[model samples]
Target: MLYYFSLCNILLLYLILISLTFLMLGFYFIMNGIIYFIEYELFMLNGSQVIMTLLFDWMSLIFMGFVLFISSLIIYYSSEYMSGDKYLDRFIILVLMFIFSMMFMIISPNLISILLGWDGLGLVSYCLVIYYQNIKSFNAGMITALSNRVGDSMLLMSIAWMFSYGSWNYFMYIDFFSFNFDVKIIGLLIVISAMTKSAQIPFSPWLPAAMAAPTPVSSLVHSSTLVTAGVYLLIRFNPLYLDSSLSLFMLFISLITMFMSGFCANYEFDLKKIIALSTLSQLGLMMSILSFGYIYLAYFHLLTHALFKALLFMCSGVVIHSFKDCQDIRYLGNLYIQMPLTCICFTISSLCLCGMPFLSGFYSKDLILELYSSCYINMFSYFLYYFSTGLSVSYSIRLIYYLIISDFSFYCYHSIYDEGWIMLKGMFIMVIVSIFGGSMLMWLLFPTPYLVIIPFYLKLMVLLICLFGGWLGYMINKFNLYDIMINLNYNNLCSYFGFMWFMPYITVKISYIYLLMGLKLNKSGDYGWFEMLGGQGLFYMLNDFSLKNQNIQNNIFNLFYIFISFWFILLFLM
Candidate 1:
């Protein structure tokens, strides 16, 4: 175990080194405006070449840097968080594998290589999600894996469709065939793939369900590896189908997803699940903005979001760990007193999530809202965007209230402290980044500012909406007369919204019905009819027949003995 701990430290150092290298390289690429595309031909069939392509741009490199940086911190944190686990080495290796797969996906512009990485993510995530070896973990892993498989299938269909264009490198064709019907289909497929991976709408339940994973895994997966892949893919493919019906469709879906996740987060009690829902909400924001043709904005938000969100998850992990793995927010309170450092980081990240001014999230989130105000979109889209932003603020405040301001609700005997130096060390770097990452990334990603000529009211709308959201969040948690009355009157409605508008029921319940049918089929066919009429039935029949035959033989032998005795008696009489 000591050796594994040392190994984790070594891996963490190496990842940090690599991350720094990538970050520097990304900066260099951005400054020089350079993109390097390297292709290695694997084979040729009938003049059609199959090759592995790598795209090294500022975007990919910067994204990779962030992914590795967070992954390194997560691994370091896990060394402390999972120190007692016997399979620490296995966990470390799985995390490294996940990072490698993410890097693979990040650099690949080719559909085939993307699929390789995409499928790798799904497979490893399932492993990580089910790491705890419980029925809940198993269920969560199943839902997660199956949900991703839907995206995988969509990507596969896109690949098949792209094969008609004679190249798997979608970047080469997206511009020339932007309006082609086949290209449109491919774009649609990619959008659906993105939706599934990002956990939009029907796929939303899996994100929260995946909370069964260890907190460290959740921190990494929810922040970067699993959930962000879809957003990244959309950013890459945005030029192909932007402003079409597909983008409109994506806009609607993402808005709904954003609204749903934010609303659900407000009602959520679990610490990690709330963060997961927030991640979902952010992904929706990213997707929606990307759909509006603000690719750089979406990418910018993705990077900044990754930094703070990872920190947020890590802080939640600390709280959960100190609380003896008690994740229910209702049972947690006054953490600011028990774990000041963790709470500080938690508060910063939470505020960042709420788009608090000057925080990492504020730069990207505020810009997104301002851009939305400037766009010539419909009233529904307009309302949903601002409403979702408010919801985001509302949930962030609600969560902070529950965790920090509320009175301690746990037992008096409980001992909760921030004693994990290594965990704190891991989070320390993130604290710095979460504080200033947004401004840095905003400047780095967008050298020229976007000129927004919006009305004064529209410019102030974001702040006003945020203020309203904060007020609502606090009041909702206050349990005042109005709140109680509303809850009593709208019990079912609250339950519906709290449950992600019954998305879990739609995904889990529907799949559960099918699973039940499968179980019945197994019982009635494999165990029932097959056992009764096939091998087991034949064996039982043969065994029964043999037993009866033995009985008959015994009876015949007894009768013969009787006849012999009678004959012997008759002979004696003669």
Candidate 2:
């Protein structure tokens, strides 16, 4: 009975969240949306099979708890940041819908339930991104939809393959404990889905485009909650990825994404955009580490990342809100003096981002490195981890340096004193947890003595690397990283890199090659090769007729046909 409640009670949480959001919108009648947090024992059900579960598991508890906290903070900050806007009605509806999808996603009992929530959130997030309905943001919004659809199709195929092992039952995940029956194919497809969602290589470019959203939006969904769904899915599938060739692939992609995004972060001048790029890098690092067999470490990083990242983004939003009309890092600085509390919050969180010692990220990120070195692992992966950590430290230092360096250049600073105290209060809550987050978290998870190993060496090394990154930035900015950009394109350059670069040229190139090959074949004699094999397609026709004439009548017999068709169509990627 209690197990069943998890699936159903989330609907109640949705109802209350939506109702309160609506009520708050009515009261404000501007752009404010309400946020509510409620907790109860939640049930999880998967059709007529594998119907009950209650999670005392450390991973599930930590993931869900962080999701709840960051989500609440984003909404609270949004109420003020979005004050006196025009899209209040529409924005609230989408926010409620987004929350609903996240809830459904976390509680999904079976892969099917998970997919439903996954796709629902995808659609809702696209709507939120295009809520402004301007010419350019909407187009960026469409690109996000297209890339996500391609990945979702892959996930759907993986689910179909899992069903094929026996039936459309997920309790049998335990039964799928090996790499037999072409499991790597589905595993690869699933990783494609995860990579896209987590904003990894090739697919990572969408996340910065998603920055067209409102600041609080970038804070909550993009930085904290939505993108993290990919990691959550990979973690959920730990049983399948436990020991396989597929895990190596996941690790490789993750390493590349981490280093690439870290380099790109230097070029991002927009505060929100820098954070967006950093989130992509950090998430890739987490997933790569997890794939290499550190489940607890992965979840720990995910949990800690959500808190500090949300805090940083929200604090950036506060900076933008106070500036009255500033958007770029150049137009804003000395924010430390102007918004001292916000600056303090941002600084602590920023250090956390660099994985400074005793901060939460330090413990989590270092443990994975510890595990990575424990065995004579892939030498390449081991070095990549070190390289990735250094870059992470670099960009984190970059955000603090230029952001505080020159002094506030705001044309008119509004002097925001935590206008939305509720949101500030929420962020402060995370900050408190974040400052002592390492100690408390370790205490909760491990025994007392072993928890004491997170140390000064890791902390000092990261901080020293960060200081060097800041020095490098001071020189790079003085010489100008792209002296050409500041001298020329400026805002246009921002639009070009941040938005235009991700257009699907690969898809177009593939299609062009396919068409060219067909044309060349027809010009020669190869076009008729199929005709020689089947003589005007009669071969498949005969097979079809013979199968139809057999007159299969059993329900189980027909079920396999439907199942196979679903899998084939799903696996049919160009």
All candidates: CA RMSD in angstroms? 6.7, 15.7
| Model 2: residue 71 alpha-carbon error in angstroms | 1.7
Q: Can you write out model 1's per-residue Cα lDDT over 347-462, one digit (the tens) per residue?
A: 89989999999999999999999998988899988999899899989889888888889999999898788899999998989999999888888788778888888899999999
Clashes in model 2: which pairs?
5-43, 6-42, 6-43, 7-43
Candidate 1 stretches greater than 4 Å from native: 43-49, 480-489, 516-574
TM-score of each: 0.89, 0.73
The whole-model lDDT of each prediction reads 0.90, 0.69
lDDT (Cα) of model 2: 0.69
- Top candidate by TM-score: 1
Clash pairs detected, candidate 1: none
- Candidate 2 local lDDT, 1-574, one digit each (tens): 2322342235335544654454333334222333222324345456433433222233443455556556655655565567667655456567767877876776564676678878997898898888777976886687677668877898898887776566433444556456766566766787788888887777876787787788877777754468988888887777667687777778888888887777777776778878888898888888887777766667667777877888888888887776664668878677666567887888899888887778877877766655555545666876676676777777776677766766666666356455656457757877897878676666555543333243566535445655676567566665666666767858566444544243345533544687788798885544476665645567778877878766654365787889999999889952
